[model samples]
Target: MPNPPDYSWSVQAQQPVDYQVSMVQGLLDPSNSSLARACGADGVRKVRCLVVVDDVVDELYGDRFRDYFGAWNIEAAWQPAPGDETAKTLEQAVAITEAMSAMGILRRTEKVIAIGGGVVMDVVGLAASLYRRGIPYVRIPTTLIGQVDAGVGVKTGVNHGHHKNRLGSYCAPTTTLIDTEFLRTVEPRHINNGMAEIIKMALVKDADLFELLEIAMPVVDAGMMADRNPLSIEIIARAIAGMLSELEPNLWESVLERSVDYGHTFSPSLELRADPPLLHGEAVGVDMAICVALAHNRGMLSKEDTDRALRLMCAAGLPVTDAVFTAELVSEALRDAVKHRDGMQRIPLTTGIGSVRFVNDLTDDEIERGLDFVSQWAAEHREETA
Candidate 1:
């Protein structure tokens, strides 16, 4: 048979990718020209750019957007997408993708500038990834959640049929511009929502950050903004740095045992199941609270440390327990997470404040006990506060 005519062939593909992330003040300060800094002075002027603003953001600052872009001599098309979690759907992504297609966006040049919280970033990022087989995009995350966690990661996705981020891609933005000024306009509850993700980081990776949160929570609760409160700014900077430090090495999640997954293991299901869906970070806080209890039960975390962690969540205005977070829900979440983790429960748990350990073995009884512990803790704390 002539050795099957030697028809088999394979080619190795390797591509090195890098992007810039800038945390700036007054990104839209017309005089500042932050987009130029993100896209490059020359590139900004030359590229065909489209600005996709979150509807909420456009409502708040629409009048200034055109002037801001024109100030830098960058003529760009502006499109607004609804910025709610419900908007993170395939249909919305298709709409944005179609809009970009209509605009004649090129795969290599013309960039899509995503401006809003995590949802807008997710849908727009996914749209940018799909349009023309992947085009460059920039993120200007407007909410606290976006600034700290979502905006920094090389992940983009839309929820699918009651599943959080079931349809997603690892498409890094050309640049991420984080302006703390935007947080000043975010509602207090939303600020607390973002704090949940930061607290997750502190619990698993930085004891110092945890301590900082303990000190800064009171100020944050009292309306701390980066422009007004140095401590608040420091807390935000630490959280962003910590997140980037963890993500830079595992952009593709090549490692299954991830410390950054600390609060994510069981939250996706809970987040989707709630009637009035919990914000992403709120769901994460509940998951982290359960993990804290799990660690305490196993003697990996001291009861004192566990209480401190739970208390911090409360002080930050995050819920550590939810009525809907039942044993069945947890089991379903774990099942879903295991499937995603290649049939292993590489669940991240705290060994100590600022340190983590991964365990593949978790029991139904243990989860029930953890849930009970958190429920009791929540009731007791509520009584004390009352």
Candidate 2:
């Protein structure tokens, strides 16, 4: 009785005239019965689905999805929070696999549905990839990060300790359902956490996205307030649209080592060192900021461009400092990220506004210098906040 949910938005930014992007949109909680009937499934038959979810969503929207699927006589089997912490373990995946085996789920009969944020999506997507050698799945992203980046991208896998995204595959979802309504129930920290990726997409691909985000900051801040702000949702949806538009082709690429990884190398390394793990987007936010600073140090980025990029992150409350960034940890993580890229490969690094390059000529000392500069900035910020 929540008045269902209204879908509306205004387009403030102009769509690209020369560019074309393909996407399929479905309601977050539409009648699945019609879909089943259209597919020639029994009107009373139960379609098997494995839902992977987290605690927050499970408590709030679980019943809604349950009822929605129940309408279609679909059997929704959920693998709720894997008690053992950490996104990189094989234990939870093994458990889910065992559950699927016990259910006697056939490859064609069962479909994996990911119903949470990045962690849940990664786990579910990986399970779908391994189960019966490949079963289709749907993504119901519950977080801004998941909706915009993780939930849409085909790279799915768990972590391997200090290293990030150490295990994964290129298994794109059959479809993704994104409802801005979901963002209403999310915490501010989570929203801020996802902004990192938005900022990344802006920096790496579209300058217009960065500019539009700047214009929408007032609305974003208001959404962070006790009350909801409409514009924030619009901005997030717009950002997702822009990202999807830019990244759709790369969505199914076998090697994501280049196109999708911009500041990720530095960011993931920082995550490993933080006492409390940094959100994926937060790490990327910090890394993007540091990359700007490093680009300036290397004489690749002008001071004006650096300031502009950093200020935009600050306006959105995205982390732009390495206050928690440590030299030793950064070195190790960068090494790991570099290794993840597979040898002295040409890694993408930005030089100017909207300009990026894949250069293998960077020395370790240059990276250390970049980390040092951001470390100093982080220290200054801490003092100011304190």
Candidate 3:
């Protein structure tokens, strides 16, 4: 029997969707060649293209991307390496840029396409933003984290010393292609990492989404117990669609910008304070619960509402508290959140579902209360299994 047709052909058929969320489509199969065709549709020649990917992704998908570009009669070069911490170094960026320049890739003639997870996107996107001022580029995100958050945003950067994404630019991609097939290789823990974003979207934007999440809470809990449930997929896709609706057209707009940062402020600091950095999603889960508690303190959310939110998160297999989320840690995270905000002004805290205001400042006392609530919830449910 003939081998299955290459993943390329199927991807092209789905390209016309507006994908306002950066023209994303969940291709069922990984189609590197199809991606080449999609890029070429805009009239880019292969030889003029420089494809960049993380070392892992390059090893797994580079040949396929190369073959695809070749099939389209395009001249292409693939840069494969861990482009996260190292890429931010001037030496690394300069070296890569110099090599591409030596290959005769000029500002007007070259298009850099990134195919990998968020880190890959950040590094390559920075390269595209900086090379000869700027160059056109595309994004093919391969991880759940990338598909939902990093892949959609124009912000590109690499870690600078200890700070994450410290050096970067707001360079939007020409197009961003998301193929869910790439997730087959993703670990379950990382998938949970991505779910942090999904849950964050539900809390800040869509009451309906939050309700839907509650309905699927059982399936999510089951996932933690080694049970198989297709509902998890449906919930994930629904959550993704809801977020894309808010982000698609206004990616650069400030309104959605603040909304996206809902739980990130406290989340990052939690990770920083932990001996082992918390997974992005895990920290997000904790932050979301904290926000719900904050809302209650501000009298925007009732105790009942806060309890429900915490319960749902636990049902979704996210921990509301960890040893690292001690009372002292919570106070520090709260203070840091206010300090590190876009403006150092007293920021409003969200008080209920769909109610985010900016004037009610949280005191240190309130922060401790929030931390205690999470700790109590964790102890109560520590032995309970889905």
Candidate 4:
């Protein structure tokens, strides 16, 4: 048949992704000029930029950013977005693009600046990815979760149809400017929320980072950002590095059997289903707790390590269990995860602190027994945590 007349042609290539995850303090300080340089603001030229700020972040330190642009002779158009879980929606992303259109945003020469928490970062990055078929954006993650976890990675997303992060893209930013100083004013509970990610990294990789977190817990009572001490800074840097190391090799998430998926296997459903909507990190903590119990039950993780992990989570101010984390919910979440993980559970279970082993044969009976163990342990030790 002469190869069916050979009508098909194929093009295979790799899209190179390069983005800097820089740790710099005083990002908004006019004297710093780091952010100005990232936005391509030359000293003599008049540059235009679109700055999207979370409403709460705007109220907290918006004026400083305003002055920063003024000092650098850059024209900034400010767009305020709601700073809540619900803000991660398609509508919000489109609204930011609308603002970009209103400002006549320059495609290649200019960049969009997302200066807020994770939701604002995700929504704005999604807008940038869609606008003009992809534009450069800079992230200045104010919250701890943003700096250590969300800001360091190259993914943009928004929620649809009650699914957490159901719509998203692997759109890397131009650069992510992380300044721990912004976390100084973050709420206590939010600080704990960020700690959950750090703990996840500790559980999955880098035992040294885990010990440092344990040590720093006492001094930095308001979470890692309360005190800019050496211990706190070291812990933050280690956590960021650890997450990036895992992400760099798998930026597109081409590999589903990822250790970084330790707490995330069932977190999407838990995050979306919890009444009042648990924070991303909170949901992850609950899932990690469940997985820890499962690992212990399988003899993959020691009871001592399981107790220590749960205790540390409690000490770090993360919720280890919740009403919505029922066995039925766990079953549903695991089913979804199997589909998400490309037909295998590939669930990451911590065999010991800072190590992980994936298992595909986890059954419903096993999960139920694990949950019962976790419930009993949680009940017995809730009073003794920390």
In model 2, the Cα lDDT at residue 285 comes to 79
Tens-digit lDDT string for candidate 3 (1-386): 99987665434332222333433343323443445544553334435677777788777777766656656667777677574434555455555676567666767645677877777778777777788877777788887778888887778876655455657777777777776656666666666677677777777766666787777656443233122234555555566676666665665544433666777756766764555656667778888777777677768888777777777777666667766876677666656555556444234355666546564356678778877766766677676312
Q: Give the per-residue lDDT of model 1 (tens digit) for 213-332.
A: 998888684246547467787788889999999998888988888899999999999898876679999899889999999999999999899889889988888888888999999998
Candidate 4 clashes between residue pairs 3 or more apart in a chain or in different chains? none
lDDT of each: 0.86, 0.67, 0.65, 0.88
State, as a TM-score between 0 and 1, how close model 4 is to the true structure: 0.97
* Candidate 1 residue runs with Cα over 4 Å from true position: 1-3, 39-47, 221-223, 383-386
lDDT of prediction 4: 0.88
**Per-prediction TM-score to the true structure, in the order listed:** 0.96, 0.82, 0.78, 0.97
lDDT of 2 by residue, 1-386 (tens): 47878899987863221222122233334543433432224647656766777767889877876776766677767767642227546666667777677767677756666777888878877877788777777777777787777777677887676566677776766666666567668787778777778777777767766777778765573244223354554556666776666566555443544635777767776776656666777778777876787678878888777777877777667676655676565566666766666675446666676657766776667767877776666566663312
**For residue 216, what is the lDDT in candidate 1?**
80
Q: Give the TM-score ranking, best first.
A: 4, 1, 2, 3
Task: State in Å the error of residue 77, model 2.
Answer: 2.2
Per-residue lDDT of candidate 4, residues 125-229 (tens digit): 899999999999999999999988888888889988867888998889999998888888898878888899999999999889888887777666554474567
Lowest lDDT 10-residue stretch of candidate 4: 218-227
The number of clashing residue pairs in each candidate reads 0, 1, 7, 0
Model 4 error, position 342 (Å): 1.0
